[model samples]
Target: MKKAAMTIALLIAVVATAGIVTGGFSYDPAAAQAAARIKVYSAEMRNYFMSDEIVKSKEEWRKILTQEQYHVLREKGTERAFTGKYATTHDHGIYRCAGCGLDLFRSEDKFESGTGWPSFTQPIAKENVKTEVDRSFFST
Candidate 1:
């Protein structure tokens, strides 16, 4: 009985160590492929942003953009639902961050979803905007 218990404990330790070394569990090739695509897309988008010619300081931004825009773009505030001019505009220009002027969504991607906020099927690039998990019930 003592030997059996020792053997079981040793096997458990071995299995746990193997799991840590081999990345916890079975691998999914599809997940790996998706992750790779996301990585490439992210890199490309970042490069695109870095290549753009616009440059401005925080002070310059305050002068150029409205208070709300400044708060949304610079301070990461979410614009109030149904309040952005771009939510209704159908112009052919790129939607930029009004505060930093960083090109965000393309005009072509904008669609009227009637959700009281501007909606887009996709952003121009992943690097153009930053997203965080909004846990506040009112945020969504």
Candidate 2:
């Protein structure tokens, strides 16, 4: 009876351990894989910027991002005078596009240029951004 009870107890422990290792624990394999896939190019590139995985059709983005963000990202819409959030924030993190999750600037690169819009001396990479001339009558 004693030997039988010990064997039963051992089996229970093994099953419990297996359960914890698999289903009962909160281990997210997908997040782990994403973390593992992140590649750091330089000390300046420590922060990871992930693009939008949703792959929204052009029409979908037109429906999703605000008019301003879409204009800035899709149509190169510059923010109005003195109204950008990043202009005043002191938080230490990467500033990403709310529309596409593209890394725009690092908090460390931010500076006060007295312009209403947030100004950064530099971005993480030049290849990450595309710029075009805006010849709106509003600027004139």
Candidate 3:
């Protein structure tokens, strides 16, 4: 199952990369801004499509999230390996996005990938997370 999932993900990455190279997957910031209320899931909601999406400005996010969280979520900074609170956690509950309280992964899907990060085999639902190609300075 893991192999199949990884294969599918790789195939998607390949296709997306091709589209990007061919100028077919250009990003539009306006489109992202327009998609304010995206689908989300929360443990309390118990429904993937019913949870309300939380959209906040950078200042608002800075006020709410911790400094580290602000750096990671807003500035696209990553936490150091093995330093995350949930990296080695064995708790029984749904994992959520730090920026928003959207349920992302089920506890059952969590696995030890030995990468010193909380890894999940899959998300709770396909719509819970949005995947896009990274076009940052470090991206190749």
Candidate 4:
């Protein structure tokens, strides 16, 4: 992560330097051509991922969700016990991912586990759920 940040900073610095090409490096037409080729490649990559079930950049997600929503969905966060609006909610609709709006648990499957957070018997479908190792400290 640190390396990625550093690389981004370096690229920014290079771009700033490019504005004053005579300062150190000479302007090269080949570099511009190479950049155009990269743009084409990026367009192709975007087209490939366009059909994904959920495809959005981190910034795009942040724009889609409010700060609190992003923290829970993108950051794999858990709401405080007895604090979530849905914790005590009893609606007749399906529970969906706040991030991508994917149908997760149906209202009929909801049950009270006395665990504060909403609990469901099983996902609406196996493909809609992913059970990763919850590395949060709360996952004792």
User: Each model's TM-score?
Assistant: 0.51, 0.53, 0.65, 0.59
For 54-105, candidate 1 gives per-residue lDDT tens digits of 4578998889888887787677677877887777888886776555445678
For residue 68, model 2's alpha carbon misses the true position, in angstroms, by: 2.4
* lDDT tens per residue, model 4, 26-103: 668976555443111122132211223466899999998988899888888777899999998998887877886656
Ranking 1 against 4 by TM-score, winner: 4
List runs of model 2 lying over 4 Å from the truth.
1-56, 133-140
Worst ten-residue run, lDDT, model 3?
44-53
Best by TM-score: 3
Top model by lDDT, which number? 3
lDDT of 2: 0.71
Worst 10 residues of 4 by lDDT: 38-47
lDDT of 3 by residue, 34-79 (tens): 6655666656767756444576888899898999999987887889
* Residue 139 Cα positional deviation in candidate 1, in Å, after optimal superposition: 10
Pairs clashing in candidate 3?
none
Model 3 global lDDT (CA atoms, 0 to 1): 0.82
Candidate rank order under TM-score: 3, 4, 2, 1
Give the Cα lDDT of each candidate.
0.71, 0.71, 0.82, 0.73
Q: Give the Cα error of residue 4 in candidate 1, in Å.
A: 41
